[model samples]
Target: MFECFLEIAFEAEVLTEEHPELQELARQLVHEDPATRPAAIQELRDMIYERGECAPRRMDDAFLLRFLRARRFVVPRAHKQLVRYCRFLEQYPELYRDVDLWGLARVGCAYEGCMLDRPGVGRVTILRFGTWNPDDYPVEELVKVGMAMMEIGLRSPKMQVLGGTVIVDMAGITMKHVATLTPTIAYQIVCLMGLAIPCVMHSCHIVNYNWLLNTFFFLFKRFIPKKAWKMIHFHGHDLESLHQLVDPECLPPRYGGTCRHHATIGTWFNKIRKYRDESFDRDMKEFGWVIKE
Candidate 1:
């Protein structure tokens, strides 16, 4: 299964009728019927106009589709999520401040966006947060890094449809790191991922867990919803167990995988920047994240 995907070559593009495989997958997973897509999108658009509280920056088919797919083509639910998303971003002005590729890399979280062979897992995002230093890197900046990665990854129609898996490596996490997660920050992070983001969160795999990580999760469990909670799997130092859900061939050596490509922050950011279009800058404007050349 792993080798089968390696030959396909990942080419990021917006969802279209040309991609029958992905379209079929979207239909099966998210109840997206092409014949009814325009109607659904318009219905959500109408709701947006009716509410008048959360108007999208751009009301194109692509942009609205993200919210629609996240809610499984349910227009009302998608409209609600969009409202929440806009409200959340408007509320948290600080999370988007002073964020860029350099600052994010210094936070010590490496992110890699790659196509996967597995069904239901279109893209794999490997987030290594063990090297994070609370003293030097604030939790807010870390959140910015996450938002940046997600924004970049979601540009791919494949990711929007098949959804993606988040691998959280907590190997070098310490008590100090755990302490930085204030109750407010915890709730915000939960809302950003679980509620506001118009991306399909298939599942999250937390590996290399420990007591300190447990302490952080104690605060997290309160803010996290039960539905999202069910998608999370904890693997305390068991790479083999992690491999059961995710194909190790896509992972690096650190996670007991044979892949040689390291998902360093610089590499990830650089690639996204190179591949990013104008929307990348436009999207970050709300958070004041300007991509400097």
Candidate 2:
């Protein structure tokens, strides 16, 4: 592994603060005697039910486990995060109101959005921003596509527990692309992603990015919650380096990696578009939420 690490050459490691103590907390949540586990879960549930005054969709033991895992299985932390997630959707319905899955897929195709075939540990995503013209599709739309992708990811049991990585390709970024990022929308996007989403973001790698990308961080870094900062990595313009961290087999040909079939942004887009069109009405509803009257 050390030799392999040197070959592609970048120092991107998963440095999340899933601390030892937190791991023990999570272990107890999952491995406690089956008899005792129910009560602990109930306690977590009551915190949500009594305080949040909302009942989110699919809050089963399995579902709650995802939250517990994300919050390091600390009941209060998980409860607070869960409440924020539900309330964000309810309060900002417009953001999700007319959820355009087809548009999302289209933009995603241009944005190079696709879940990788990483079978062992968790779901990993590679999002190529430079794949298409940002002028053709606004960055705001691209951000929404990301949100839609997260929603799509969580629908799977594996991703909910194991979480995922997001690779943002920056080769195509130009002044046109950067122009779309307003402070307000930028604030909204990160907060929505960093806080409101229930899925655990194992890590994110920013590749092929140029100097312009740093301006984004400089402008809005404060807006992002601190915990997420650790998950981000910078791998400037080097596919060889990225390939070190992510298997080349998992990447699309455009990225100087081996993945060919259904790998490009457009390929995944068409697949989703076709499926969504085939079942258009059924699948594109506003996201499910939990709120009390």
Candidate 3:
């Protein structure tokens, strides 16, 4: 199969503070009254057990809470969402088919990076929009790989429970790249992050963006939900200012942080690529079609 290289630092001391709401949700999922529990929750559980399908190691009350909270604990809607999540895995292998893919799809980690996790802010993510090389990868591949990155992040323990922050570096972007930000991609990204993936995006920082893209970005904002719209922040080119939000210690050298090795983006790419094929092969065996029986 494929591979995965990133090693999550599970140091208990590094974990900052607990997310009270999520802790309470975990409490409710286990201790709350069965009758008061939404019917859809039980139905989804029944369906999973009935199929005898094996869930991944991390699929616990925390995972169930994502769906429940997404639909606000409603029975029917939650049921539909649960079904959609499974079916999406079954059919949309190109996109939703990730559990089946080894390293979250064959997508490269060009535009995404994760490894920086802080306590209160959760998982610190980097979107190197400056690394966009359309010649190397097309739009379709971008969407699929991008979704894979999101899935990987959600699977992370801290991100799944405490939520996370995203840093979108806009340093090198121009009108040439704006074409890739199609309406379909924008809408799908919003829906994917908000619905399919359950991590709470606590904040999104836009650093080094040239003011010229404001009109385009403003138009792009219309397609996303108000919840996501509120999370986005523009920091322009000031890395020092950005450091106030994300500590310099958490960032790469280019951004004035450290990756324990080289601070350049190339090192970052090299780091994530190590797990590439291994993750793919193992995922297919673990979550693919035969397991459905």
TM-score of each: 0.84, 0.72, 0.63
Q: Which whole-number lDDT from 0 to 100 does residue 204 have in model 3?
A: 78
lDDT of 2 by residue, 166-203 (tens): 67777777777667678866766665454777766666
Q: Please estimate how well model 1 matches the true structure, expressed as its whole-model Cα lDDT.
A: 0.71
Query: Each model's C-alpha lDDT?
Result: 0.71, 0.58, 0.54
lDDT for 135 (candidate 1) = 67
Among all candidates shown, the one with the greatest lDDT: 1
Model 1: how far is 40 from its true place, Å?
A: 0.1
Candidate 2 has an lDDT of: 0.58
Write the residue-wise lDDT of candidate 1 on 1-293 in tens digits: 65444333322432232366788888888899999999999999989998898967779888899889889998889998899888887778666655554456555444555544356665667766567666675777777777766665566676677777778777777777777889878777777564788888878889877767768788888877787878899888888888888778766677777664444555556555555556666666544776677
> For candidate 3, lDDT tens digit of each residue in 1-293?
11222333322212333455545643333233335555545665665667544342334554565565445465455455555565445445656443333332334434544455554455566666557677665655655655555554444434554466777777677776776777766655554555445555567788877765684476468766676667777777787877787777667677777643212233332443444344433543454311121
Full candidate order by lDDT, most accurate first: 1, 2, 3
Q: What is the Cα-based TM-score of model 3? A: 0.63
Better of 1 and 2 by TM-score: 1
RMSD (Cα, Å) for all candidates, in order, is 3.6, 9.0, 7.8
